[model samples]
Target: MSVRIDITGLTAERIHFAPSPLAEMGAALHALAEPAHHPGVQGWTTSVSACLDPCLADRMCEADFLWRTTFSDVFTPSAGLPGLHTLPGATLGEELDLLDKLSDEQFVDAALEFTCQSEYARRDVARLDDPRARERALELAAARGSHQVRFTQRLLEDPPAIRAWFRELMQDCDEAFFSDVWGRVRHQLVADARLKTDLLRRKGVADALSAVSGSVSLDDSGRSVVVDKISVGHTETGSGSLVLIPTSLGRPHLWVLHRKDWQPLITYPISSPGLTAPTSVEQLTLRMSALAHPVRMRLCRHLARGSYTTGELADAHGMTAPEISRHLSVLKKAGLITTRRHGRYAQHQLDLSVVSRLGGDFIEGVLR
Candidate 1:
């Protein structure tokens, strides 16, 4: 499933880049909720989580029912938020104030809209008033579990309580750990946004979008930005603008929020800061060293045609099984080969993409 945004009438002026502290807070909460999705930040997540109040952590766990695909959409400053003008990017206080100001009815409506969108791809305002639609949405929410269904029911039944609960969660989160997390990552986020702006100026929107993530690309018409997502929908950017946000905590996932009547937004992963010339050179050197051995080079040539077991490779290369195993371990660690087990046999094969990228990777490293 994917979301296609038509950029036919959009321009450089229509595109903006910024970092949102509220958004980062939501992402941090999400990482705490689903640690498996963010293996890169496990240490950070654990350290921060350990510092939280036990009661507050329990409250956060209770709130996980709202995380259908990610941190609850209701908690995020989506495009539909009444006055979430992210052009300048709001401070955490500013965004929380915006949330605090939403009237009971408005907050309820937003919660319902997010609920409907999580189950169905569309977020029709009319669905809020449709009793049948609400029931059906609740029914689909059941697939996630009774806990989520009950959570949505409570949200619909007691908007004021849910709103207050959500608000307190954010406030406590800021006090507990997210404030410091933001302080630590704010500079990196700003640097990424600036880098994106420069890329947009030099290469145009498509390339800039590509820089955001490999999952973003243009359709054949060159008028739409296709984002790979689990839910499918289409949005036309008639006169609406687009906002691109950079986040250090939102690693390994790209999130897109689109609405027919508001500006669309995308939160993409921050590029690795460790992608320095030294690191690149080290990787190239490692892969080269792995293949530098005569036996290893011969193994690569043989594996290129097809996979072979350790015993087969040893016999073919006039070596012992242990010798072939040691050489395979080196190739595997360098990411030049892959091993898969089939019953009692483990087959080794060359990874063609890594092999083919060797020259380009070396040149890119040197230039960097």
Candidate 2:
């Protein structure tokens, strides 16, 4: 469930963080499909919902075929961003023009490859023939639902329509949702890139990447970087560089895409108030402030035992519920804890991975 990237020959200069409108569009679509995964982007989601054509919004929210993992690659091709090292300077019209140029054969081939990667699709499409694959594709499609099955069948029968549908979705999102969202977050995205650059200048590539998330870390041998929550694993022995893209859109999780013909890319969430670790000095200072208090330290230790409600923590600490609530809020803001509502009561639990890393990082910073 992790990707072990072998960065043996990669230099700090080779690692780049750039913004991508195509990547942002893909992230926005993902957020729309699984709103629960991105609680921090509720405001953007609401704005997107309001801007989208009612039918399109409903399809984005309620349709399974539209949100399928295969469709992400299908919709957002690498051609949109011809240069991997910088924010794609291409206009939306240019990007869409590139998408429109894709041949029907390319669409069909990519779709088949994507479908084969799916667990359900692989089982159904036992043979490689188009007729058999098409027949079985319907069975695979039916797994998502009957409505989607027909749509999938049509796409399989007429590959050109797949391109048309993808273009339509992108056009809708580019005009309706992505333009506004990107305008609002572009500054933060640039700031995040600057912070990473500063970390590279002050610390090193290893420390800069480690600071990104608890889920990303250097191995004991120091030859590999392991990214958690990814099912696929591969070693890059080629001479290609690694691209690191920081985006406000891809919050709450990191996305990795590897291709032999292109630089391996990692799109991670930039630091934000309610999302993940703070990468810059100001943000880090605020996070470190949470641990500066003794009462909060005691509360963190207590929560480490197990999840507890505000009243339960108050009773254990001999404090009022409001006092415990304030302490919990600080811990939550520091990314050291998470709270979930269970009926009328809320349960709080320590994020042990982050807490342990913070302790180790503090010690290392002091010793150095």
Q: What is the TM-score of each candidate against the true structure?
A: 0.69, 0.63
* Residues 1-368, model 1: lDDT tens digits: 56788889788877878888877887888788777677789998888778889999878776665552464444444454454343533677777666656565555555555544554335454434778766876886687677668777887667777877787887888988988888899998888888889989999888898888766777778899987654566776666667888888776667776644545778877888653222234457779899889989999999999999999999999999999999999999888998899999999999997898787665433322
Residue-level lDDT tens digits of model 2 in 47-93: 66666688877655433444434234443344223343333333555
Q: List the residue pairs that clash in candidate 2.
A: none
Cα lDDT of all candidates, in order? 0.73, 0.63
| Model 1 residue pairs with clashes | none
Candidate 1, position 80, lDDT: 49
Among these predicted structures, which one has the highest lDDT? 1
